[model samples]
Target: MTLVTDPTAPRIAIVGATGAVGNTLIELIEQRGLRYRDIQLVASARSAGTELSVDGVAYPVHAVEEFDFAGVDLAFFSAGTEASEQWVPRATAAGAVVIDNTIAFRMDPDTPLVVPQVNAHLLDARPRSGVIANPNCSTIPLVRLLDGVERRYGVRQAVVSTYQAASGLGHPGVEELREASRATLDHPEEVYPGKEFSPSLAFNVIPKIDRFLDSGFTLEEQKMLQESRKILGLPHLDVTTTCVRVPVVNGHSEAVWIETQGVVDRAELVELLAALPEVTVHDRRSPHEFPTPATIDDPYRVHVGRVRVNPNNPRAFWLWLVADNLTIGAALNAVQIAEELIARGTL
Candidate 1:
């Protein structure tokens, strides 16, 4: 493959180059063979000067302060919300279209919040804000399925309980969980000194993710409700969530209970879910055939299983979903958005 860009390729930049999502972005770009005129790896000051390889070519990671965005056509910002708030405008001002993976701009009226699979049509033109917001990780997988269901059967409400992984907090959260797990197994009484997770996450689950808002729902939970409404184009959609942080090192799962406007058939429901793009529903004859975070075969696709209609209420049903938080929830979705923009000649 040619390392130099062709005339049509865009020059791209990856912010937060040292984070989990950033790493996954680079991997996906290579895996999908995204054409780029040039690629820049950018991170905070501390991570600068380190070199990372994209497609076997080592490029020095640049400090955000030093990275120039003047000619960059597309930028993917996986940095924290604060970083996006601070640096995204600079990138946009310098003529880069930003695909941000943060809560900062998802609800911005000028910036369209997008999950390409669910709402790629929003990318028909560049937004007024010069940025495209990637939805919350938990919201992306949920909306992808809900979009099709809403179109087919009409969804009235959705109740979701997410089993999130430590990786959602990035590399530090994963490191802390593993270290804490080791410490707990060796010394059952002493607590591991943790700055990433409170009360420790060793063999324990935390029902809260992000800060608690005034409505008794955590910020992460609130993101799901609001982001889903935006992505699905349902202003009055009902979605209540309980976001939990589990001990799993990667992959996030959700147990979803949905109530539709009309009766849903079990066999038809399985076929409908299976027909959706990049979705796998494991509903064979075996009782144990269900998608779990640990058992998912494809990290890039949303894995669904345990499809069953409510016995008493024909309008309700339950299902299980597993997605790679780093991939489907963050990097893959961002990459797919870029693909859509490129296809539309908007990038």
Candidate 2:
């Protein structure tokens, strides 16, 4: 394990720089004033030679196959699972700490799947595999907000339904939505096949996300269940999820109902949520104030609202949460893990 003694001089690489999550990583670096001595952009061969601007300077994108990982203190991988499977080991072998934002190694016992706000302590010890996994886009915020509650009241079970954005599928999903909407308005009677969505996502919501497993749960929903348990260290915690892709283009929202093992006061829960870092509370009914996909202002903070106790069960409660799927859900959390590693001198 290596740490950047200078803090500002670590060489950083962004794999899949042309993709939405990778682009957001660059944006967050610039916005948060994260300084790296050298920053390299690597993408697929087809996107090679593309220039991505960072802090007013344009960096030429290199093909992952050709990019040398030497001197790269950390590599942020947002490439798809296939690309990660191919390049992650090579990057790690070249002495770079790989923070992978793919599902390929997330479930692997050797890879520490992390959401910095929740389980950043995992970074105190170096990963034996030289890789850390960024959990699914929906899993990050959900686990972050649930961390304190689980710690305090002991979460017995969680029932979550995600209203995922089209952007969750990447840049192609965004384009597909726009194209499908235009095609639908122009030819309302004809059937338009969406590229990333099963049905057209223009004016509709797809209840399925990722492929359905044999248990009737989509991979995305399973991710929320499995990843949450891993992050929260709740192996026996019962969890169920239904992941839906909505018509929106950026923010991902979740409607979560959590059953606690012990009694929890509503006021105390509100106060508890407000105290959590990177979590905003807007639970109010008179003004109809609550988090919505269209109303998320801070991309970094997980906006939590509409907190209420379940009428049917004394131990159960409901809440709504939304966050930028590209930022907090993916890039920001990935980078934060790297930062934690650096701070702990364990990268």
In terms of TM-score, the best-performing candidate is 1
- Candidate 2 backbone overlaps, count: 0
Cα lDDT for residue 94, candidate 2: 92
Which residue pairs show backbone clashes in model 1?
none
Candidate 2: what lDDT?
0.87
* Top candidate when judged by lDDT against the true structure: 1
On residues 31-150, what C-alpha lDDT tens digit does candidate 1 reach at each position?
998888899999999999999999999999999988899979999999899999999999999999999999999999999999888889999999999999998889999999998889
**Candidate 1 TM-score to native:** 0.98
Off by over 4 Å in 2: 1-8, 284-287
Q: Model 2, 1-347: lDDT tens per residue?
A: 12125655578999999999998998888876665778899999999998998888888999999989987989999989999999999999999989999999998998999987888888998798999999998888888878899888989888998899989989999999989999999999988986788789989988998888999888888888889889888888788998888999899999999999888888888889888998889873322579888887788899998888877786889999999999988999987887788778786
